[model samples]
Target: MVKIVALVGTNSENSTNRQLLQYMKAHFANQAELELLEINHLPLFDKPADKKVPEVVRQMALTIESADGVVISTPEYDHAIPAALLNALNWLSYGIYPFVDKPVMIIGASYGTLGSSRAQAHLRQVLDAPELKARIMPSSEFLLSHSLQAFDENNELIDQDMVAQLEGLFEDFLVFMQITSQLGHAHSVNQKLAESVSWENR
Candidate 1:
C-alpha cells in the first residue's frame, strides 16, 4: 500500500488545517493509507546535536522517513507558514534528514479571502533549502479559502468543482510518489556502494 503522512500546521486547539487534513485522509482512504503526523507534542527547534531529542521528535522523524510521501496541510500566520510547523521542519532538517528529497504535496486552509497561498509559497522556499531539499509537487496548488464554509458540517469539502480538481491532484500526486520511490531506491543503492568502498579502503 502507498503510505502517505499528513503533517498539520498550527498548534491551535481547533485548527481548521487539521480538519481539512482529516477530510483528505478519509477522502483518499481507498487509494492510499494516509496517516496523520501529530506535531503537537513536538518541542521548539532545539537542534538535536546538543540537546537530548524528545521521543516525540524522534517518532516524527521516523514517520516521515518511513512514509512513501508527505502531505503538508498548513495555515497562514502573518503571510507565512505557522512557526510551529516551521520549527518542526527545522528539527527534522538537522537530524535524520527525513525531508531530504522526500516527495511532498502542499495544501492549506485559511479564514481570510486569499487563503494560505502566501504561506504555501513561503513554505516552498523553506523546503527548497539545502538541508530539506523536498521535492514538492508541480501541479496547481490547493488552497481552501474561508475554510469554515468551504466544508460541510461533516467536514467534507462541498464544492463539487474543487472535489473534481482534487481528484486530478490526487492522481498526479500518486504518480509523483511512484517516480520518487524509484529515485529513492536508486539513491539508497548508491549510498550502500559508497559506504562499502570507504570501508574497503580503511
Candidate 2:
C-alpha cells in the first residue's frame, strides 16, 4: 500500500480541515495507508541560529520523507493558510529537505463559498520555494465549502457529489505520485539545493 501523510493544516480544537482529512483517511483506507499528522503541538518557528530543528519536527519530517506522498488540508484564515501550518512548514524546511521532489496534494475546507481558494494558491506558491520544492499536483482541486455542514453525524461527507469528487482527486493523486517518482532524476540535485538555502545568510 502507498504510504501517505495527511497534514491537518490547523491547530483549532474544532477544525473542519481536520474533519476533512479524517474523512479522507477512512474513506481511502483501502487505496492507501493514510496517516494524519497534526501541527498543534509544534512550537512556533524561531529560526534558531544553530539551525537545530525540534525533536518533534524532526520526527515529523522523517515520517513525511518516508511517505509516498503528502495531502495537506488547509483552512483559510484571513484569506491565507493558518499560521500553525506555515510554522510547521518553516520548521520542516529549515535544514531538512523532506519536501524536495515530494509529491503533494492540496485540499481545503472553508466556511465561506470560496473554499480556501486563495489559501490553496498561497500554499502552492510556498511549496514551490527553493527551500521546499514540493511537486504539487496541478490543475486539480478539492474544496469543501460550508464545511460545517459538509459532513454527517458519522463524520463522513454527506454529499454524494462531494464524495465522488474527492474520490476522483485522490485517485489522481495516486497516479501523480507514481509519475512524480519517475521524474526523480534531479531529486538529489534538488535536495542539495534546498539544503544549501540559508535564510539567515540571505
Candidate 3:
C-alpha cells in the first residue's frame, strides 16, 4: 500500500483543521496508509533557518521522508499559514529536504467564506520554492469555508460537494505519486550511469 503522511497545520489541540484531516483519513484508509504527523510535538525552532535541526525534528523529517506522498490540512490566520506550521516546514527544509520532488496535496478549513484558500496559496508557494521543491497536486484544492457549519455533530464532514471533490483529489494525488516516483528513480539511474561512465574514462 502507498504510505502517506498527513499533517494538520496548526498547534491547537482543538483545531478544526486537525479534525478535518482525521475525517479525510477514513476515506483513504482502504486505498492507502495514512500516518498523522503532529506539528505541535515539534519543538518551536527559535534558531535561524540556517541552524541545525533538533533531534525530534530530525526524526519527524525521516518519517515524512519515508512516505510516498503528503496531505496538509491547513488553517488560515491573518491571511497566512499559522506560525507553528510554517516553523515546522522551515525546519524540514534545513535537513535533507524531504519534500524535494515529493507529491503533496493541500486542503484547508477556515471560518471565513473563502475557507483557508489564502493560506493554502501561501503554503503552495513555500512548497514550490527553489530550496524545498515540493510538487503539489495541480488538479484541485479542497477548501472548507464556514468550516464549523460544514461538519455535523458527529465530527464528520457533511458537505457532499466537498466530499466528492476530495475523492477526485485523492485519486489524482495517487497518480501523481506514481508518476513522480518513477521520474525520480529514472533520473537517479541516469545520473549514476553518467558518473560511472566518467569514472571508466578516467
Measured against the true structure, the TM-scores of the candidates, in listed sequence, are: 0.88, 0.98, 0.87
Q: For residues 22-54, could you state the per-residue lDDT of candidate 3 as single tens digits?
A: 887777789999888999988766654445678
Worst lDDT 10-window in candidate 3:
193-202
Tell me how candidate 3 scores on lDDT. Answer: 0.82
lDDT of each: 0.82, 0.94, 0.82
Return the lDDT, model 3, position 112: 80
Superposed model 1: Cα runs more than 4 Å off: 48-51, 185-202
Write out the backbone clash pairs for model 1: none
Candidate 3 residue runs with Cα over 4 Å from true position:
48-51, 185-202
Candidate 2 residue lDDT tens string, 130-187: 9999999999989899999999999999989999999999999999999998999989
Q: Write the per-residue lDDT of candidate 1 for residues 1-202, one digit (tens) a residue.
A: 8999998877888888999889988999999999988677777775445555677777888989899999998899999998888888877765346777789999899998877999999999998876677789985588888888888888899988878887889889999999887776556644344334321222
Candidate 1 weakest ten by summed lDDT = 193-202
